[model samples]
Target chain A: MDQAELAAKFRNKDIKAFERIYSDYSDSLFGVIFGIVRDREIAEEVLQDVFFKAWDKAETYSAEKGRLFTWLLNISRNSAIDKTRSKGFKNKNKNSDSSFYVDILETRDKTEIDIDVNYIRSMLGRLKERCVKLIELLYFKGFTQKEVSEELDIPLGTVKTNNRNCISELRKLIQT
Target chain B: MNVEEYIASGILELYVAGVLSEEENRDVHAMILKHPEVREEIEQIEKAIVRHTAALAPGTVPSFEFIKTHTAGKQVPVRSLQSKKTYSWITYTGWAATIVLASGMFFMYYRINNLQQDIKRAGDQNIQLEQQISDVRKDAEATEELIEILRQKDIVTITLGGQAIAPESFARVFWNKKDEIAYVDVSGLPEPPEGKVYQVWSLKLDPLTPTSMGILDQYDSDNNKIFALANPNQSQAFGITLEPEGGSATPTMDQLYALGVVSAS
Candidate 1:
C-alpha cells in the first residue's frame, strides 16, 4: 500500500498498520536518529521514543502538514536533540562535536572497504562541501536556518538559498 | 515563482526540515498537494538527505525490539488497573474471604472455558515482555561502554563539518591515538542507499595517501551510530569519502564527507 493509505490506517490505531509502518520506516528512521545521538544505545532509546511519539500523535499528522517521512524525521530530530542536550549525554561526551555527523560518516568511509564507499564517494563527489554541511544541519542535525546561519557564519537569507543549491545537487546525483 | 526556481529557492529543503514559518509551510504544503512534480522533487530531496545522513551513522544499529520494550512497559499498568480491582481487595480482608474463596473457585472454573484464548494471549505477551527486558539490558550495556570510551582522558575529539554534499551532516571522531583507535560517531548522517555501506580510512597528508581501517559493515544492525575501528597509523588528518559497495583504495575527495586535523595534546 502507498504510505498515505498506511498512514491513514495507522491513524485509526490499527496494530497491523503500526507494524507495517515500523517495518517500512524503522531502519530508515533509525538511520536518522542514529545520525544525531551518536550513541547506538541512546539512538535506539530515542528511536523507541520517536515511534511511540508517532503512535500517540498519529492524529496530528496529515498530508497537508508534510509527508509521513517528514513527520517522523521531525520527531526523530527533536528527540535526538533533546537527548544530546540532556545532562547524561553532556557529561558523557564533553568533547562531542557540534557537527559529529560528518565525523562518523568520514570515519566509516575510511574504514569500510567492502561496501559501496565508491558510490557514496562518487555521489558525494557530485556535491559541494556547502551542500554537505547544509543538508547535515537542516535534515540530519535538525538545525533551523537561523541556527545554521549562525553556526556556519553565513547570512540568514543565504542559508535557505545555499541549502537549496546543495539539495539540488543531491537530487541530481540520486537521479544518476 | 516558477517550479524550478521555487525548488531552487531551497524552500523545499526548509520545508522538509520544517524550518519555514507557518505561512510558508502552508504555502509549500499547498503547492505539494497541487503539483505532483513538486511532491516528487520533495521526495527525492528527502531520500537523498536520508541516504547522506544514514551514511554518516556508524555501525549496526540496535533492533526494533529495543524500541518496543519500554513503550509496552508504559501501557501495562494502565491496562492492569482498569481490569482487576475493588471488590477483590475488600472481600479478601474480611470473613468474606472464605466465601469469596469458594466463589473464586467457581469463577476459576467458569473462566476455564476461555482458557485456550487466555493462554495464547498470555504466551505471546510473555515473549514480548521477555524480549523487551533483553533489549533493555543490551541497550544499557552498550550505553555503559560508550560512556567509558568518551571518558578516556587521552581521547581527542574532532568535529567534522558537513561539506557541500550535506550541510546539515556533521560528525565527531574520538581519536584515542594512544590506543590507536578512532571512535567515529556517525550520528549526524543519513542512511546510505540500498546495496551501499560506508567505509572508513586513515589518511596521511603529505602524500595524500589513504589507508583502509575498516568498513562500518554493521550499518543497519547497530542501534547507536558510534563505531570503533583500529587506526594505528600516524596521520596528519582524517577524511571520509563514499565508494562502491565494498570500498575504494584512494579517498574520493568529492565524496569526502568530513575532514579534521589532529591537534597535538
Candidate 2:
C-alpha cells in the first residue's frame, strides 16, 4: 500500500500497519533520538518507549495536524529529550558527549552509520555550517521557530525562510 | 493565488519540522489538499530531511519483533473513580460533647456505607474492564495466529468469488497441501437463512465431485470468521454452499454460493 493507505490503516490501530510503519520510519526516528541521547542503550530504551506511546496514541492521530514522518519525528525528539531529562538517564550517562548533531557526518565513522552515509556526508559537506546547525536544531532538537531564531541570533522572520532555503538546497543535492 | 510563492515562503519546511503554530499547520494542510503541487513540495522536503537524518542511523536497531513482543497486551487502562460525595452536617446540640459524639458516630456509619458502595462499584467496573481486556487479547492473539499462518510460503491462497446464487458473497481458502488443512475465511458471506448453514466443500474439477468439509456452525459468534477445516482430499478447487443444517449427502450445485479453482502455483 501507499503511504496514505498505510497511514489510514495505522490510524485504525492495525498492527500490520504499525509493523510496516516501524520498518519504514524507525531508522530516521532512531537517528533523531540517538543524536539527542548520545548513549546507545538509553536511546534504545527511549526508542521503544516512543514506539509504544505512538501505537497507544495512534487512534488520536489526525492527518490534518501533520504528516506521519513529522509526527514520528516530533514524538522521537520529545521522548528522547524527556529521557535525557529523566534522573535515571542523567545518572546513567554522566559523562555522555554533548556535541551538536551537525558534526555527525564528519565525526562518526562510516561503518557505524547507514548505507547512505556518504551521500549524507556529501550533502552536509555542501551545506554551510550554519545551515547544517539550523537543520539539526529545528529538526532534531525540537526547537521552535522562535527558539531557533533566538539561538541563531536571527530575526524570527528569517528562521523559517532560511531553514526553507537550507532544506531546498538539501533536496537539490539529493536529486543530483 | 501563487502556488510557487507559497512553496518558496519556506512555511512548508517549518511545517515539516512541526514548528508551525496550530493555525499555520491547518493552513498548510489546507493548501496541500487544495494544491497537489504544495503536497509534492512538502513531500520533497520531507524526503530530504528523512534521508539526511536516516543516514546517521545506527547500523543496527532492534527489530519489529522487539516492538511486537514488548508491547503486546501491556496496556492496562487506568480506571476513573467517578465518585460524587456531598457532605452535609447541620447539628443543633443540647449538650456539646454528647451531640458531637452522637453526630460523630452517625457520620462514621454514613461514611462507611458510602465507601462500601464506592468500593463495590469500583470492583464491578474492574471486572468488566478486565473482561474487555481479555476479550480484546483473545481477538488479537487469534488474528496474529492467522497472520502467521497466512505468511507461510507453502499456503496456497485461493480467492473464491461470488456465484450466481449469491453474487455478493465471497470467501478465501488458505490450502496447506502438506498439512492437509484448509482455512476458510467467510467474512464476505451474508448471513444464512434460518435452519440453513454454509458448508465448505473440497472439489475435484476433473470428475466434478464434491466432498463436504464442514459446516460453519460458529459463523455468527466468530469475530475472525476463519474456520480451519481438515481437508485430506486431493482437491483441485474449493466451494461454499448454503445447505441443510446437517449438510447434504451429495453435491448441492444449485445452492453453490461461492466457487474457485485452485490455480497452478
Candidate 3:
C-alpha cells in the first residue's frame, strides 16, 4: 500500500503494516545505520531500536511533514549517531579511528551481494563523487541543509538542487 | 510551473532526503495531490532511491517469513480467515450460554434480595409482638398481686363513702394491716382538674383531726389508676380531698371527696 494507506493502518497498530514496513526497509535502513556506526552488532541493535521506536512513535508520523521512509530514515540516523556519541562508545573507541562509508563499502564481501551487488557497485562508482558525498551527508548522516552547504562549501540555495541532481544521476546509474 | 522546472528545483531530492522545512514539505505534498504527473515523478524518484539503497546492501532477499517470525503474533492471516467458517456457530453458542447463565444468576440475585427484605420485615413484627407480650405479662402479674392481697386474712376492705363535698364519688381502700400497706382503687373518684390532685388523709375521728397520708401522684398516667401507699398510721377513718398538686399540709375539708370509718364488724 501507499504511505498514506500504510500510515493509516500503522496508526491502528496493524501488525501487517508493521511487517510490510520492516520487510520493505529494514535492510536499507540497516545499511544506512551500519554505514554510519560501522559496527555490525551496534548497527543491528540500533536497527531493532529504530523499528521499535517507529512502532511506538507511529502516531506522531504525518505524511504532510515528509515521506514515511524519510521519517524512519531520520529516526535511524539519529539513533545511530546517539550510539556513536555515547559515553560507552567514547570510552571503548577512544583510540579507534573514525570510519567512513567508503571503507565499509570496500570491506563488504563479494558474497554480501548474492546477485545484485555488482550492478549496485557499478552504479555507486558511476555516481559523481559530489553526488555520493551529498547523499551520504544529507540522507545517511542526517545533516541539515545549512550543514550540508557548509560542509560541501556550496551555495545554500543550490544544496537542495545539487542533491536533487545527484539523486537523479544516482537513480539513472542504478537503474540497470 | 512546468514539470521540468518543478522537478529540477530539487525539492524531490530533499523530499527523499527528508531535510525540507515543514511548509516546503506540505507544499510539495499538495502539489503531488494536485498533479498526477508530480506524484508520478515523486514516486519514480522514490523508487530509484529505494532501489539504489537496496542495491547498496546487496544480499539475499529477506523473506516475509523472517520479518513475520520476530513479530508478536505469528498467526497467519489466512488461518484466521479459514476459522471464519465456524464463526456464526461459535458466536451463537457462546452468547446463548452466557444469556442462560446471566438470567439464572439474575433470578437468584432477585430471590436473595427479596428473601432479605422479608426477613427484615418479619424481624420488625416479631419485636412489636414481643413488646405486647411483655406488657400483657405485666398486667397479669399486677392482677395476681391484687387477688393475693384480697385473699389475705388480715386484709381489711374499707368502703370509703362519699362525704358532703362529693356525695356521688366513692372509693375502696384494701388495707393489709399485717403488711402495713394500703392499695387505693381510685377508679371511683372523678378526674382531678389540671394543676390539682386528690390527697388521702388518715383520721382519728374522736377529735376528727385528719393527717396527710400521701397525694395520689400522676393519676392521669396510671392505666388502672390504682395506687399502693404505706398506711402505717394508727387510724379509725380514711378520707380523700381535692387539693393543689403537691397536696396541702392538711386536708381541705370543703373539698373532701370521700370518708369511711373502720367499723367494729
Candidate 4:
C-alpha cells in the first residue's frame, strides 16, 4: 500500500499499518538518527523511541500538515538531537565532533559489509562540498535558511536559491 | 500568484525540512493541494532526502518484531461508555450472603478490602510471570534458530582455542563457506574491559593476513553471545582480539584471545 493509505491506517492505530511504516521508513530514520547521535546502539534506541512516540501521538498527525515520512523524519531528528543534549549523552559524547552526514557515508563506505558503498560514494561524490554542507545543515540538521546562510557565510537572500539548486543537483544524482 | 516562480523559490524544500513557520506550512500545504506540479515536486524532494539519509545507515535495520514489542504497551485512551446506574438485586444478595457469613459489617468490609489487595498483588505477579515467559520464549526461539544454523550439513564448525593472552578463553565459529557467513559464539570469552571490545578476524594463513570481520559491541547483553558476521574471505583461520571500542585496523596480536584454523574437509 502507498504511504498515504498506510498513514491513514496508522492514524487509526492499526498494528499492521504501524509495521508497514516501520518496515518502509525505519532504515532511513535509522540513518538520520545515526547521523545525529553518531552511536549505533544509542541510535537504535532513539529510533525505537521515535516510533513509539509517533505511535502514541499518531492522532495529532494530519496529512494536510505534512507527508507521513516528513513527520517521522522530524520526530527522529528531534529525538536524536534531544539525546545529544542530555547530560549523560553530553558527558559520554564530549569527544564526538559535530560531523556531517557525509562523514557517516564515508565511514560506512569503508567499514560496512552489506550496503552497496560504491553507490553512496558515487551519488554523493559528484556534488560540490558546498552543496553537501548546504544540504547537511538545511535538510539533515533542520537548520533554517537564515541559520544555514550564516553558518555557511553565504548571503541570506541567496540561501533559498542556493539550497534549491543544491537539491536539484541531488535530484539529478538520484535520477541517474 | 506565480506557482512556477514560488516552486523555484525553494519554499517546498523548506516546507519538507519542517523549518517553515505554521503560516508558511499552511501556505505550502494549500499550494500543494492547489497545484499538481507543487505536489509532485514536494514528493520528489521528500524522496531525495529519504534516499540521501538512508544511505548513511550503518547496518541492518532492527527487526519489526523487536520494534512492535516496544510499542505494544502503548495505551490507547478508551472513550468511556455511558451506562444506566441500576440497582442490582442479585449483587445485593451476593453481598448480603458474604456479610452474614462473615462476623460483622465492619469486619466483613475489612476482610473484603484485604481480599481485594491480595487479588491485586496476585494480578501484578501474573503480569510479571507473563513477561518472564515471553522473554524465555524469545530466548528459546533464538536458540532454536542458532541450532538450525549449526545443523546445516555444509557448515564447518571451527573451535577457536584460547590464545596465550587468554588461555582460558575459547570460542566457536560456525562457518558456512557457501553463504560466506560465520556465526561466532564467544560465550567462553571473558567480558571485555571498559573502553575495549572483542574484534573478530578472518585470517589467511600463508601471508598471515587478517581481515576484520566486525566488533562484538553487544557482547554483554547478547544472550546467545553468538554474532553473525560476514566473512567473504578464503579464510584459513579465525582469530579474536581485544581492541579499542571502534576496533583496530590490524589485530592487536598482544591481546589476541582466541585463534583457530579451519580443518581441510
Best by lDDT: 4
| A-chain TM-score, model 3 | 0.85
Stretches of model 3 off by over 4 angstroms after superposition: A90-99, A109-120, B56-265
Residue A124, model 4, lDDT: 57
Query: Residue-wise lDDT of candidate 4 within B99-198, one digit each (tens)?
Result: 7877577787898999998886675455446545655876898999999989999899999999999899899999999999999999999999999999
lDDT of 1 by residue, A66-130 (tens): 77777888888888888888887843434456445345555455544222355557765677777
TM-score of chain A of each: 0.78, 0.84, 0.85, 0.85
Give the lowest summed-lDDT range of ten residues in model 3 chain A: A90-99
lDDT of 3 by residue, B1-265 (tens): 5666688778787787777656677989888887788778877776776665555443443455644444554355664434335457889999999999999999999999999988866754554465456557767888887787778899788899988877888998888877888888889999999899999888898888888879997686566777888989877989899999999999888998988888765
Give one digit per residue, the lDDT tens place, for model 2 in B1-265. 3787688778899889887655667889899889999988888888888878776666667888889876587767999998886544533343666878999999999999999988866754554465456558768989999999989988999999999988988999999888988999998889888899999999898878889899997776678899999999998899998888888777588998999999876
- Give stretches of model 1 more than 4 Å off: A90-102, A105-125, B59-265
Q: Flag regions of model 4 displaced more than 4 Å.
A: A1-3, A90-102, A105-116, B75-265
lDDT of 4: 0.82
True contacts kept of 4: 0.61
Go through the candidates in order and give each one's C-alpha lDDT.
Answer: 0.72, 0.81, 0.75, 0.82
| DockQ per model, Cα | 0.16, 0.25, 0.17, 0.22
CAPRI-style grade of the A/B interface in model 2: acceptable
Interface CA RMSD, all predictions: 13.1, 12.7, 22.9, 14.1
List model 1 lDDT by residue over B1-265, tens digit each. 5786677667788887766555566789888878888888887777776666555344454565664564456554444446665576666577677888999999998899689668856754554465456558768989999999899999988887777787788778898889889998887877877766677777777777788877777777677889998899886667666667787777677777767777755
Q: Least accurate stretch of 10 residues (summed lDDT) in model 4 chain B?
A: B123-132
Give residue A176's error in model 1 in angstroms: 4.0
| DockQ of candidate 1 against the true complex | 0.16
